[model samples]
Target: MSWDPYATLGLGRTATADDIRRAYRKLAKELHPDVRPGDKAAEERFKRATAAFNLLSDPALKSRYDRGEIDADGNERMAFGGGGPRPRQSARAGAGAGGFGGGPQGGPAGGADAFDLGDIFSDLFGPGFSGGGRGYGRMRGRDIRFTLDIDFLDAVNGAKRRVSLAEGRTLDVAIPAGVESGQVLRLKNQGGPGVQGGPSGDALVELNVRPHAFFRREGQDIHMDLNISLTEAVEGGRVQAPTPSGPVSLSIPAGSNTGKVLRLKGKGVGGQGDQFVRLLVMLPEVPDEELKRFVKKWPKRDQAPPRPS
Candidate 1:
């Protein structure tokens, strides 16, 4: 359809190489096969965006395209600018040693092997066409996609996973440790077969890391609120704290207060981080008269109350 590359990538002709790259990356993220699986329209746009970015990212090729020396596909345009078909001229001007004004069997003016038309054609239509006529005979296979959701701990700790394909076939998948939401894992040659002996497309697994019931993430650290009785906050004791790996006994310092962050080293995802436990001192539903009396008459209790952290 003679689509302009800039238009395909949603950019102007004046866009710099970096601008083009940024535009492509943004579009690719939104339209990746794994992101919008089964959406053929988005897939087509994604491919076009990729191709346009590739063409515009090369300085020589982009300059040639801007000068009308080449088309968006990096092919020399059939008609130069607005002029008619330009005659192929000699590389050294006039004619070669073997020919002059047509002669020596009308040998190409420059050298014996003047130009490589095959290379030009190949460049124009991707590396698919090799001969005189243009063709996409061996088409690449269509990529298949699947959404895989794993538990938060499993995702953080890494686990052997499996997925059931559309055909009801189960395949084992390796879940990488510390994998984040929206991450894509590629499965080679697990998609649709290629046409005319082309290589098969890949299987794209879009991973979703489920949120933990009590745990939250910050960088590599895991955070959760550790609830303890008000008495425990005043008296030091060990309490059971949940880690992604399992429940572990965590020591609470005497006089521990609410919003206190306690660290457990090497307890976070993949053992690369520490687990931060935020202490939440819970008051007894049944009020303690002695504790209430003590708090009410505690002389130095509130010269200044601690501010919220």
Candidate 2:
């Protein structure tokens, strides 16, 4: 007796298509050949999982197996070989019965009757059994590749997102902290279905971090531009800057220029890198009449430039 595909996969006879898919995915993840390369035990488990998936994935084959018309290993039942129902005969004496038990002359039971085991096998297990009893052989499912776009903040802070596949399956993927663009996340056993009891493939997710308008990443460091008023730039003051963690106060030096950068230590993604804030000093727009009057009497510096004659 061949191994029961359903039993090998740990699925019931009434398992639905979705149930079969879920089981295959779970098993493939646990028994992927590449993941456990050089390990004989894992390889055997992978083979068994693949076989179960192949048998259950096909509607015709699954139906036949469920009806007991085919063996668990996908071989045709012995009773089907005689062609329909045979005349009742004692099991012990039937082996020696001559001429297919008194059939018409030169009929299906006569000397001219030739039984092609290949034809019977083909009818039972589809055409082309080149692999002997190894069952159907075909390409496994294609490996799936897709990109997941995550917010910069989320990438730094970690987040959970739901991803949908073309097969109408949605999976919840957790984005780890400090993940960068072009990073690949492998979800084992989420790829295409295998054929002939072969293992399914995998789903590979490429991470793409969306750029933030205000925050930028430099290695593990976080960079941001801080807008400061003329008074704050000239007088040097404490300003609030945004970091991956949250808003934090940063000190600005007196006479700070438009391009001066200040670093806040250990305020970045993993709290191991620094946060850099570049100052952008904004001058006040043309003053109104009341402000212009006050500025007209403001102190002015007297200076002279030396020119070579």
Candidate 3:
């Protein structure tokens, strides 16, 4: 069947290189055999998409295809955009070295247009061809990319995660400390197998860090809002605060107010970054009668409340 690479990729001929790459990656993630195991329809779609990507991703091949010099399968097409077989020339005009007409002054046959049909055929047939054809050299396998979701704390501190791959294989990916969302971790020689003893491709794992309930990270620093009772804000005392490492005793200053950020050094990411705790003063859910009476008769201060730091 005649294949249209652009249609297979769901793109127009005017799509840019980046567009083609993105389209193929999206399709690969959805149609990969590993992703949709046992789905024969998806497997076939994956094969077709991969084949189209292989051809369209090559600038030389893509140019030739755009110019109608080659078919979708990379085979040479008939001259002048004709679908019929090429018209044969006279025996004398075609008879020469390897059946190619000689160039002017015996420079070279067909001049700049000359190319070895044997090499093109060899490329099509691959290295396994044993019918007196030169085999294509060893080639490194293509790299594979996939996304992995991890806990927020795992991203702050280094962690190892096991991921499954094609062919029932698994990989242990080491996530480094302070890894952010969209960061990639590459595992060498963990992707597709190489051809003809060539080196294998690498596996690229793109991380998606799950958000924490109370913690937010900025660079290496961690920030979180902690609720404190009004008495703790006014009288000051030791209170427990959460950090990326663990809970720690925090000394609240007297008269501390909301928006006051306290720094806990070496408690953020990998024990290198700091954790900032912002205090939010909270009132009692149900005020007692005695406290209400005391508040009703309390004198108003002449000075305004201090601004939070």
lDDT by residue for model 2 (70-93), tens: 444333332110113222121111
lDDT of 3 by residue, 1-309 (tens): 346879989999998877877787688668655557789788667656654665566665577669865545433343110112342121111111110111000111122332322333244444544223222123343444556778899999888877665325677888898899878787887754443344555666667788999999988889999999989999999998878777899999999999999999999888888999999999888878877887778787344676698
Runs off by more than 4 Å, candidate 2 = 1-140, 286-309
User: What's every prediction's RMSD, in angstroms?
Assistant: 20.0, 21.1, 19.4
User: Which candidate do you rate higher for lDDT, 2 or 3?
Assistant: 3
Which whole-number lDDT from 0 to 100 does residue 176 have in model 3?
Answer: 93
RMSD of 3: 19.4
For model 1, residues 1-309, the per-residue Cα lDDT tens digits are 245879888889889756876686677668755557789788667656644654566565566568865445433332111112332221111111111111011101123223232333344435745422312223344344445677898888998876555334566889888988778788886654443344555566667777888999887889999889987899979999999899999999999989999999999888998999999989988888998899889987778765698
Residue-pair clashes, model 3:
0
> What's the lDDT of the predicted structure labeled candidate 2?
0.60
Pairs clashing in candidate 1? none
> Could you estimate the TM-score for every candidate?
0.55, 0.52, 0.58
Q: Residue 305 of candidate 3: its Cα lDDT?
A: 78
Each model's lDDT: 0.61, 0.60, 0.63
Clashing pairs in 3: none
Instruction: Show where candidate 1 strays beyond 4 Å.
Output: 1-135, 300-304
Clashes of each: 0, 2, 0
lDDT of 2 at 244: 86
